[model samples]
Target: MTEKNAYQQAGVDIKAGEQAVELMKDAVADTYTPNVLDGIGGFGAAYALGSNYKNPVLVSGADGVGTKLLLAIAADKHNTIGQDLVAMVANDILAQGAKPAFILDYLAVDKMRPEVVAEIVTGVAKAAKASGMALIGGESAELPGLYAKNHYDLAAFAVGVAEREQLLDPNNVAVGDVLIGLPSSGIHSNGYSLVRQVLGITTSERFKDLPIAMQETLLTPTKLYAQAVWPLVEQGFVQSMAHITGGGLTENLPRAYAKTLSAKINWGSWPILPIFNELQAAGDLSLEDMLLTFNNGLGMVLVVKSEDTQKVISQLSQTNQAAYIIGEMVNGQESGVVFEGDAPW
Candidate 1:
């Protein structure tokens, strides 16, 4: 075996990894539920499955921040990206009518910085606490060549649980079910590749040059819907749900529809966010592309019976979440989303 005298010269820093662990350990501990059996720095984290669930089904989702990380990097914002990470998976599990139980993150960087790593973990901890999930453990890796200095990537895996009978099944979604649109907190971690193209800015550009509102909107963290949605699920008002992520309404909404049903989204039913409008005009993007790309405004769509629409909206309002009756599921020619009226774009 060849002896390598200096691992630091090769760009991997063992001490930095240890420092990161020390910095984030307390924040990680803050997300622990009574079920969490072990803390951070364990070779493997453990969480006891409580006996509360008789027929519990574990719902798991894995997601990354995508090009949105570039925006975060550009803005020198590390905190909100963790919320985006949790929202991406927690909302997915919520769509299935599950309660988020625990989350673990994977953060990889070319060089490790304790403060940066701790800032990211703090964001994750904030989100995990919001979702009522334990931040059991995670890995922070320093891969010198894979990423550039000051550049890092985040990916997270979340596990949720639902009683078998409580799981939201798309098959339960039927014709005439109304689609309720829950307004997003800006972009919510998707469609940024086009956003950057429209703005024509590099990752290093300070967002300060843009209008303050636009900058804030772009950096707003993804909203966690669990607190609002869980109640509706328990009340048996929500039939199904779709987390509008990468595919926007064009792709995601269909995931919750029965084969016999197609979603008819009413154009102009909800207000489209200004950031989306800015992107469309700047990019000269067509209505088709806009609908297929950005979320426009709606973040998560709840499919409910027509009679239950007002109830759901009213409940969401209590949480300071404004919702709209954006559309309905219909027995149409095909099983997909069909936008009604002229394109708002």
Candidate 2:
């Protein structure tokens, strides 16, 4: 038998890391914009920011896929989660009305597996291209002690540029502005820890045993919103926007507007995704917990003037993006998100 090298014996494989990089090279190249100045092997990636805006503001967001990674890894599915990683950050900056320009990812694993890493990065590259961002650079860390074998975590930092005056402002989000919701692709990337508990997915084998379609649905990558909402931002059609994430609508909506204003949701205006309903039944969870955690159905919400509501919804439909008017901003004393009617649970 061939003897293991010193580093290999220590659980760090340099050859494997190099191979992973080689495998991901093509995918990474595919996402490069004309502004990209360096290749995958460079010490640092570079991009030339052409003078595009009169007064540019840089918007950045950092996030991980959270426990959603657990489900993907358990199922040995690597392709789509990378997109989830990208979406978490991309959508966040989009909430600020910024156009995503580039992304840097960090992947850490217990032991480097070239094929798996490549698969993950290919998804990332695809998502970056879709979101109009360059996959500029990233790191693949093999930390033996920090993670379990065949286990890994992925995070991304996205940087975007927006004109100073065009950035979405909470101060400008006035009462009477209508709320428009964009549907989600499954739960996106949050509340998965609860999902696993609710579904009783206690082991990799159990997760793997689920019907293939269900597995795919559960692991569906987060939807990129730059294509859907950027046009509205460019046209000054939206006063503010919220990317419903870990905190769901109850928490995230308030961040989009001034504290004096409250979002009043008209329950049952939009149909909740079946997956959330299934989870609620299985876990016997209260409506409050569901809203406090999962997005229930909507992924992104826009604050628009009532006059522009139909125009905004019509434009989204033209792009094959389905949006619904779910609520409106109110001048009432209630703070944050205020529920008006009971959800048709």
Candidate 3:
């Protein structure tokens, strides 16, 4: 007769997973705000709701780290990727003019590595706290046979709330509204699949020398915009906002607005980040392709009336966020974003 062990017998060490959670206890605690009801190691996490706003509408978004995972694997730096995971969802919901309430993370790994797991979770907690969100619940799974030893995946879900009147929509955008652009933290999480496909398997040192600040820019985590845009939204200064993600500016701006109005962007108004230039040179990617594919340099954008534009910029500046007056809304047959000259790509 043979004695059987737990999943630990099959290389998935439950004890090691538990130990990993124990190690992350302190780091996770550092992210807690008044709304977070418990620590990270619970089956369920709780939050206080219904007491903060009138007719609080809950907005939620779930997103993963995307192909940027390859960079983490290549550099062996897992912490910042977790922040990217949180940023993806939180920033998306923030575009709707909602204040983040709580966050939940999901981590799946081929094997249990206490240190690496802790580092990744620490990053998630950091972003959540930075956005004034509570890290309430999450799941960690260890599957030895499902993945390569060095492979893992991370996903995050964030919930936000706003009063019905506080919500922003493009319907409020008039032809005179100005387009405000927010700077991105480099390549962000999109187009990496294309990046790796173009660059292939290069050494980290060589990856660092690819014309731009590859190491710093590539490792740049996603921008969390909740704290920066909340005040503007609360003051009713922002008419509508867009979070540039998978589709670049052209695709995302039409989301919260009606198609009858079009946006004309001034290419020279914003400075294109060096990383984008390098990608253009390296891949010889056309201007149109680049504009449709990446955020270029702008991450989040706020649309405001001409009268309120200065106030919006001043408010954003006070929050340490630089806002660019990229262009203005215009009349067009189509209801999408249009480029007047060249996109600042």
- Model 2 off-target regions past 4 Å? 1-4
Q: Pick the TM-score winner.
A: 2
Mind sharing the TM-score for model 3?
0.93
lDDT string, candidate 3, 1-345, tens digits: 766587668888887889889988786787777777777766788877747687888899998988788678767888789779888888888889888878999999988899999999988888888888877878889978887768888888889889988888778988878999999988788888777656653555556555455566788998888888988888898899998988888888878567878888887888888778877877888877787778888999889989998888988899999989998888865548777675443
Best model per lDDT? 2
> In candidate 2, which residue pairs clash?
none
lDDT of 1 by residue, 1-345 (tens): 655549877988888889888888888888898999988767998989889889989999999889888777777779888999999999999999998999999999878888888899889999998988999988998898898758899999999988999999999998889999999988888888888778876656555577777777888999899988898997899999999988889899888976677998889899988888888899999988888888888899999999988888899999888899998888855549887787866
Error of 3 at 284 (Å): 1.5
TM-score each candidate: 0.94, 0.96, 0.93
- Candidate 2 Cα lDDT to native: 0.91
Which residue segments of model 3 deviate by more than 4 Å? Answer: 1-6, 202-213, 343-345
